[model samples]
Target: MHSSPRIRTSVAATVLALAVVAPTAAMAMPTAPKAPVEAKKSTQNYKGLPSGVSKKKTLVIGLDGAAAAQINEKNTPNLAALVKNGMLAKSNLYANPMAPTVSGAGWSTIATGVWPDKHKVPDNSFANPNYAQYPDYLTRLEIARAQSSTLVVGTWSPIPQKVFGEKTDLRLAGGNDAGTTAKTVDYLKNGNPDSTFVHLDEIDGAGHSSGSSSAAYAKAHATADAQIGQILAAVDERKAKKSEDWMVVITADHGHTPGGGHGGSSTGERATFVIAQGKGIEAGSVRHDVKISDIAPTVLKHQGVRIEDEWQLDGQAAGTIKADDFDSLRPHLKTGVDETKPGTTTTGWTTTAPSGWSIDNSAMPAGGVTEWQGWSFATDEFWTNVDLNQGRETSVHNRNVFAVADSDEWDDKAHAAGQFDSTLISPSYKVRGGKTATLSFASNYRIDGPQSGEVFVSFDGGEPRLLKSYDKNFNGVETISIDVPKKAKKAKVSFRYTGTNSAFWTVDQVSLKK
Candidate 1:
């Protein structure tokens, strides 16, 4: 995760700098930041393993805080080999923006094949975690087959307790990376567990101690490569002796900042990669992007474990890679809003000129700015002011680009009075043979007071019918389901933003599915 080891600077910078910087006697605090509200942890217990077994074995290697950018043949030869022989070498799989890019949440996403909504791990502390309800894949495997052997080895002690859970039969949680590697190799050679998970923390430690771009980080990665090479050697020997098929998957929980901190949504922090090498995986078959949740299902599928719908898994098997299929409401419509500059044509979708929607890249009133190189707009808020020297960027919705309808001109005033209305309509969709449809999009809105705005749907040149109404403070993604009336064969959607006094509405990634 991004925010850690609070490094305070006495000199001033911006709102974010103040947010993270420890207070000093010489400085007058800009504003006492509100403490983050954590979600309540659940205490539900799950059932034991049902009787079943898969033919193939599985191994998962998790590298904490490893940035894809830092990976190279010269620095990490063993990892390079795995990538060269696996599906991930040519693919671009990103960790979904489910929660902050932190170890506990990212690893939970990897282990459970679900987002934070299901696992409920928001940070590293594992505070109020709901892992009992959403157990790890190892635990799921145990549930499927009570007699199956499972092993977990990690230098990070919390990973075994917080991520792998209680199902594993052999857990070597504490020790240095080398010691952990020795244990994993020994277990691979002798214990022969059906499913295994290996966690390495030194690379991340190096990133935090030395910058991610530094030589020290590179050396740490190299040392880890040597250790992994030894473990792989054991796996090869086991495969040769037993003639057993195995699937090996490798991935990282999150990426580190250049300065070695994480827990934010910056591109660097969100950077993650996955590699699948073994039975049924395509060699040199590259995928453009994959989610971390996909790893669990992919591994299970390879192990011959049946993934049922009742499990409510968010991932699919890695065997088949397909283009966008409009099974969900979002795949039908082109992107009406994306991370693009104001006045520029959005990449996938189009809108009418009369539409009041425009992108806003300037610093928000909350003191967040999109620090893209092309962001030339001047920010005027006192707390929002910050130098671009450290290359830190902030966004209102954790992104640089967003569609906005603001009440005042960019540089004019603090707030505006009276109504400021805007509508962003979608390109027409021919949903002739489709059933009920759903619309989803991410948005952040602010008003002087009270709720204001509505989402509407129109059927084939008919009047717009209300879909959903905005009545309170909302700052995240919203999905609305609409049943297509029998009379309509085609439909169009629009978000009507209406507000009085000071207000602004920002939207992105609008999609529809039937």
Candidate 2:
């Protein structure tokens, strides 16, 4: 029997399926409960409504692990239509450097309008989540205004039933896209739900079985687009029959790697998009700055729910919705370096290698290549799992940068580990206002035998001061921040990789900001 395929619950909440991979061991999987359940009766229902001529309702479609680059006019017609008439943005997901990027964490962030730190869901296990402190938006809606009808459905039972853990007016579980669409259509036509959420699982599944850029994944994307069209059509039909004014929003929890695997801090894994189509949204407008956590507050605001400061959410309403608080939010990296290509050189970086460090573009995972010994930057295709070369295709760590020692090299020999005793120094840059400079960068490293990786900074060419260090094993793309010396007029950073190495050190998007 095949093992159960790894399933990522919707990073966002919805009743639709976002299962990226089909269950491998279908027999081992429990049968999905066949019907919908009624929500618990509320003791008190808040009757507050927005004062307007037309009633307002919300519909959110959560497409799990969908990438913006893959969606377009021809492939995802429905999504395209929404974009043509709405606002779209390449939104960023707040990442936890220490945790694996999975469904539980992503979904919780989406539901609560906060990052993983607030929701406290770091992995798929969903242990010790701080739901009481940061409950899902639906739960907030149910509690604040119990009279409003809410619907939540998803094929992934864990997400709908456990992760979000909200009791809506109507909740459905376990169904294919066709079934989900039909049920959603019936509910929209017959019942008037103030808020609705739908999830889709097929595209993510295809991304797992076949690579995200593969034909199978493309087909799955098309299928999801068609299904979304059906759901929108049903909403329109409902509008035709009634005086319902609906605001439709769509978003994804995460993006998949080119090789069809995720859970890293690579660009592809963290990149996601948001689409808001409503009366206020600007048609065909594109935004670069947005976040997945912004969805909950936006939806609540549109529904006339007053946002309370006591909730302590991390997101503000984005897109067309006016939000004055978002101005305080700014990019962590204002200035930096890129060294992920062949023959790349920094004007100020000085290298100290007994064997000399040079820029090259190849690596030998199975064995060491003599030609790659002096290579400066790590090649994008140098993953330990070489079979999944495509994984290096998209959002690769700045196209893969490297810091290695003279003896360090990737080898095919199972036990042939070497030490990397080399250092690369950065150019001197002014730290404005004496102490305003702070440095941050993404680094990925692997070590096998002994010793470790270390980073140091020399202020005005003073004694090297240690900043941070790492031991053996894998440290995925991590953002490390350090404070520069206030007294130093110039700062030179250094990366030291000196230890028995099974894996090399790679850094990218190095930034020094005031």
Candidate 3:
């Protein structure tokens, strides 16, 4: 019997996937963050606007789960416009392979200019509840303020609220309408201090849960773009009233996998954007090889504050511009799944309530709705498995046992039921902006029993639009156009199953073309 595939859990499965990476020897990563740049206290105890007719101001805007696949030029006109006008830094890092690559770790890296290991805030919940320094979601504001007069606004996380203190300017709201964009405006307008930051998380949330190509994903991009537009407008509004030197920095904590995950090993996670405008940013700038942690120091430099080199950060001021023109493109690196190791496959559909498991074609397992949405089982004794490369994760039902292997090839014993189960595998993919594309592939659903499967497409990885579903049609495996809209950054297709009972299916070698 053919062996089953390797199943994994969502980073979120880690309860704070953002903070954990599968532990490994600490790589001799990058540099450390310097001490917080100190602002020269106002000499006069005067209340109100003073200074040589206003000094330049610095601002930092962070987007969680923001990346090329999640939001691109075509879908996000405002952000795209910002890129066009400012410096665009396409490649950057937030965490190491050891880091879970989850939100907290990723954002913290951007915030403290340090890694998970250095910051000691690895996952969502760390050892012994310590509400001491830098807070987490659900904490109070005063907790985060004892050190600095920081202002933080967040959507799903309470860390910002805790870090900023009770008097801290922190707000929690919906992802859309007055989202991260609005919080930023308030910070810039009121708490316009030497250091200020606003976090946007919709992009990543939509992309990670929904495929990057789903309509939900598209909506997220559009919403974020609209909010970004407002942010730009706010900046401009301030500019109209009086010259406020504001340098806007935008970048993602980390990218996600085609399967809507980042914790797993994939080239996508290492991919993020670093676009900046105004003040020391230099217009029409384009830099490469910038990491998330580097933004802090870059902001410090722009404000003309000297930072102590004690923090030990990993990023450097990057790029070259029309005003920039200083940096170069970041290294193009893409890591593929280790095929030689235990892998997932949709070789057949489980039927007759196959004691093993059954899942949908979208790559979800058939067994027990993936407790917390995991990819594979911890053990293989009783679970039927399906695996694939970067798309919606395949699922398994009846598969309950769990086991850990150092490699990809799984060696476990499993029995089959008398009847056939039903299932289909669907995975998400990505495409560049302004392109008409095709997703072509070859798949086989072992069970011929009253079943129909097709490859469906979604805009930003939202819903599936039937590209072609079949009971037993393998279209010679040539190539087909996916017909993506003008504005598509992510694309996804799945072998949809319209059959009774749950079963497994097999699909391979899928690609997208313009």
Deviating ranges (above 4 Å) for candidate 1? 1-53, 89-101, 240-245, 264-267, 279-288, 306-453, 472-481, 496-514
Per-residue C-alpha lDDT of model 3 across residues 293-354, encoded as one tens digit per residue: 56666765555544454334443444311111111111221111222122343111111111
lDDT of prediction 1: 0.58
Q: After superposition on all CA atoms, how large is the RMSD of candidate 3?
A: 20.1
**In model 3, where do residues sit more than 4 Å from their true spots?**
1-54, 70-73, 92-97, 126-150, 162-179, 186-194, 239-242, 280-282, 319-514
Q: 1 or 3: which has the higher lDDT?
A: 1
What are the per-residue Cα lDDT tens digits for candidate 2 across 286-305?
A: 76445677889888888877
Q: Mind sharing the TM-score for model 1?
A: 0.65
TM-score of 3: 0.48
* TM-score (all chains, Cα) for each model: 0.65, 0.57, 0.48
Q: Best TM-score goes to which candidate?
A: 1
Supply the TM-score for candidate 2. Answer: 0.57
Error of 2 at 221 (Å): 1.0
Candidate 2 has an lDDT of 0.58
